[model samples]
Target: MKCKTIVGLFLMSTLAVFSQNASVVSPNKKISVELRNSANTQVGGWYLKVNYSNDGKISEVFQQITLGLDRADQSFSTALKYLKTSKPNLINEHYSVVHGKRVQCTNSANEVVVSFENQGKSKLNLIIRAYNDGVAFRYEFPEKGGTFVVNDELTTYCVADSTKRWLEKFNPANEGLYTSSKDGNLQQDWGYPALFNTPDKGCWYLIHEADLDKNYCGTKLSNVAEKSKYKLTFPDQWNGRGQGEVKPTITLPWKSPWRVVIIGSLSDIVESTLVDDVSTPSIISKTDWIKPGIASWNYWSSNHGTKDFKKVCEFADLAASMGWPYTLLDWEWDTMGNGGKLEDALKYIHSLGLKPLMWYNSGGNHTWVSSTPKDRMLTHENRVEEFTKLKKLGVAGVKIDFFESEKQSMIQYYLDILEDAAKFDMMVYFHGCLVPRGWARTYPHLMTYEGVRGAEWYNNGPEFTTTAPEHNTILPFTRNVVGAMDYTPVTFTNSQFPHITSYGHELALSVVFESGIQHMADRPEGYQDLPDAAKTFLKEVPNAWDNTKLLDGYPGKDVIIARSKGNAWYIGGISAERFPKNKTLSFNFLPENVKYKLTLISDGEHDKKLVTEYMVVEKSSVVKVRLLGRGGFVACLKPIL
Candidate 1:
């Protein structure tokens, strides 16, 4: 009788361990996510299986999505009861932004909220959304106003070992190059917006997070447990100058940020607005003052140019000559010499009808210990005082630098500055910062983030001379897909160090990189010496676009893209290989039966020069272009009117 009783209890417990499962699919039925709550699995207590449909052929892209919640009070990771799933609902909305890859965007997804109860009876909700482009999910604690301590989040993603990935090593500032590998080896930390490609399945995936706010700490991926599995890892003790805790302490009734997996072809990865789709909409009501345009920056040419009043005016003159609307007065404007003060430079800039942007150090012991103009933007009172004075002086924007941390406090600091800046109608740019994760959508006044090893690195080291070409090709697929990246591109002349990329490659960056304020990094002399056609193209490049499309190429080898502003289209392409590449530019994306004039600027026989040609073409025309090793090209298409 005793043995029979023990056997009955064991059977009941086994059944309870793997109780319920649910699935959700995209509205188009192309992507699906399946959740299995099995307490016995090594993937925490819950795991997800994701599949994608290509031409009616289904393939599994993700094997497991480990999920759990550890709190100081209780563990939501084990022995959870599945309650019920809400009916799938469609969310389709359209919105416009101040500046981005495109002016307008659409957010459409099919969503379902799955409910659960932990052994301690604490309720948790898992909300999943499936879009044609990707899948996103997040956790929610619906309980009322009480405090909770999140010891850790046990969310990990597992994929097949054969998949190729371009992952950047984890850093607080997110300023590292992406390493492409497929050796089944893992790193202790990998940054977000990690790109993966499954050649056999004909699909691409980019993993990132969205809707991140002050309530939580930023996270990255760590596959130290298993090479193919990457779990969510918080910031290390060294980050934020070791000032803040790695764990997040939050108030109740809070939903964690969405873990977004962008899935599709390379085009889908490039053109998808899935990151913006999952983030919060614009919180600022008045966005008319926020404008996107090219800016004449002196830092690339003379890092301390602001100290010389003549140098400041030269850049302002460059902006005026190029028909750009703004000139950036880089750091040290506070100590201006050689015939002008801060007010004097502002007056001169405005006299030329150019808006002036000033730079500031983020002002903390956390980073950039030696930079000046520090501590002016660290608090609300300081920002209000500074911004009020700037607004009174007609300063258009503020470029705050050196925030080298991803802790919850730093994240809140970024938000606080944005919110405060908006009140005074000032646009903001962040340098020495974390990669953008959809904050541009939430804060329209936020212009750009310099979280890349961009042109400025040319001044710092010689390694960029060789690695930059490959890095530039990969960014369109990885970093820039999330938000505006301030690469400070288009330098025709050398900085302290010379770039090995060709003149045509330099010209193409003005189009290839998307930034709210595209900083033309060359000196005035460089622009004056450019061919008439190339200079004209520089003047016509638009910072904001109406539409964008990825035409061809791969991650590290080459890339071609076409972007439209109004009725005109701009095409940019670059090659990263040591050997030359030949590509055919098919205008099939153009309106059928329409004639257009194409102005093509391509690499010359030599790397230092550029060659320009003009031709009349239609939607059916296929123009061939040759990119020299480490070279590029750009073209403009306007309907023959």
Candidate 2:
């Protein structure tokens, strides 16, 4: 019996963990991760040796992947919680599929789940899943009696000190740039859709969050005490004024959001749906009312000069003329009501076949509304009343802004608003808030999140303050990968000529950026004055796409991407921050057998002007482009008979 007991003990620790070198490959065997425990001399609690397989070359990307958790009373943590954890038994695992309903992306995917547990009475489980696109895992605390306080959740993604890191500040306002670095040095405790570039080893990993609900407050990643490692950090606290320590008290059987790591080439990272896949399935059973498309915005042009019903109607007419679906009424016009002005304007917009998206401050912001903004929507009843009134007025969507807090209370408010908005058959856009972490998947009506330093920054000043070209280039892999971004791109005006990235570069943003509700921030006159090629793109560009392909480029530098919808494809390319003299692209992403008419909207001889070209291209065709100082290009390809 002693002999039998020893044999079982050895098997329990060794079998579930496999070995330090042994790993599990993804279903397609493209991605693999090796697991090992510190009990066996691995430094971390448990290490993940991740490898990527491209063209059959197995490259180890992440050598040390481990995580830990801590509590307030210091009673438990991922490090010591598992110390008394014994038997490390492998529980049952399986494969599953999640469908994206009412969205353009449609597919069936394979997912493999691996679960493990301690055989002792106190059960602390760790579960990991290897999807063809990426890998994700979370801790499971399953005891059921009462509440507990958690101090921290430590997730470490270890990379080489020499690796490239695009670090972003943890501004709750979501306003900042992705300054590049080598040692992962950050000015503040920050988190972003951070990109870790180690191309030589064949891995460009994107770190982000997914499926975050009320269970936990928002999390951002910061550097660990040890060099060459990054760990998860939460807002220190929470209240009305700004972000603060999150109340970590929670009920039994809680889990963390899937800490996601997307690996592959730049294209693979750009086209990943891992965040969407791991998110909660759609809560709205009937989603036909949710629509994704472009909008004409008013904030950029100072609410179209005089925020009245007449000026708003002019913008609505402009939207209809551009074949766009919505016109956003921003500023005090939507909130102050302007003496029943918004109601009249929205009704007129609907008659023109254009929807009206009104803007609102997420309570307690004295900036927009004048009186009783507090008494407006402080409860469930208030939200239902507001949404019901808007639904009756035929308002299609709302842009709620200035959340500025990452507390659980604010997070819960977001869920409550989304639920209430859905009941009224309205689409939603959240601004001045958390970066979208798979909320679009859960609340299909949630179209976009303006957690990006997008075009709105242009309002801060003249040309110099405008959204920089490099910022646009780096977003696809980070912010765009996590979910739809409300960048409010596409500005075509001659007044901002001196500071503008070339006209072609601005045009290219249509294809390069991904958002459910793409907003045109330029003035109405700007749209009317656009070259025919620009107008054509404005009408044809899609807010949601069936597919996306990253052809080539680097982070904070030049990038080219192709996005498709229905039968046509749109491609966007932008120069690096410094702006290049020119760029050349291959039409290889197009089907080899399909002949197509490719129209290129490019920079004119003068950087300030726009030029367009048309050609019939075969599979072998290569197109050379000139991008003078912050320039870019946008093109549309349609298969021709």
The Cα local distance difference test for each model comes to: 0.89, 0.72
Supply every candidate's count of residue pairs whose N, Cα or C atoms clash at under 3 angstroms. Answer: 1, 7
Worst 10 residues of 1 by lDDT: 14-23
lDDT of 1 by residue, 1-641 (tens): 99999998998775554333367888888999888856544233777778888998776778889888888888877666777778888999999887888778989988888888887778888998989999999999998888878998999888787889999988877889989987448556888889998747578899999999999988899988888888898888788788777788889999999999999889999998888888999998878899989999999989999999999999999999999999998889988999988899999999999999989999877884767888999899999999999999999999999887888888899999999999999999999898888899999888999998899989988888889999999999999998899999999889988888888888999888999998998999989899999999999999888988999979999999999998999999999998888999999999988899999999999888889999999988999999999999999999998
**Model 1 TM-score, 2 decimals:** 0.96
Root-mean-square deviation of every model: 3.4, 4.5
Q: Choose the strongest candidate by lDDT.
A: 1
Candidate 2 lDDT, tens digit per residue, 1-641?
99999998988786555562235556667877666666754223666678888897876678877765665544333343233222222322321222221134422233333333333334455556666677776677766766677777767777776788887877777678877887655535666788887746477888888888887888887675755777777775533464334756677778877888888777778888778767787788887788888898877766333266666777788899999998988856634344347667776888999888877767654223342234344468988888888888888898887777777777888898898888889888888888878887778889888898888676665643444777888888788778778888877663332346777887888888888888988878877888878897898788777667888788777888888776688888888666456677787777878888989888787766888899988678888888767788888899997
Q: Candidate 2: where is the Cα deviation over 4 Å?
A: 1-17, 20-23, 41-44, 56-58, 72-121, 199-201, 224-227, 238-245, 303-306, 334-340, 365-377, 462-467, 494-498, 577-580
Q: What is the lDDT of residue 15 in candidate 2?
A: 57
Question: Clashing pairs in model 2?
Answer: 69-78, 236-244, 236-245, 237-244, 237-245, 238-244, 579-630
Q: Estimate each model's TM-score.
A: 0.96, 0.88
Model 2 lDDT, residue 22, Cα:
38
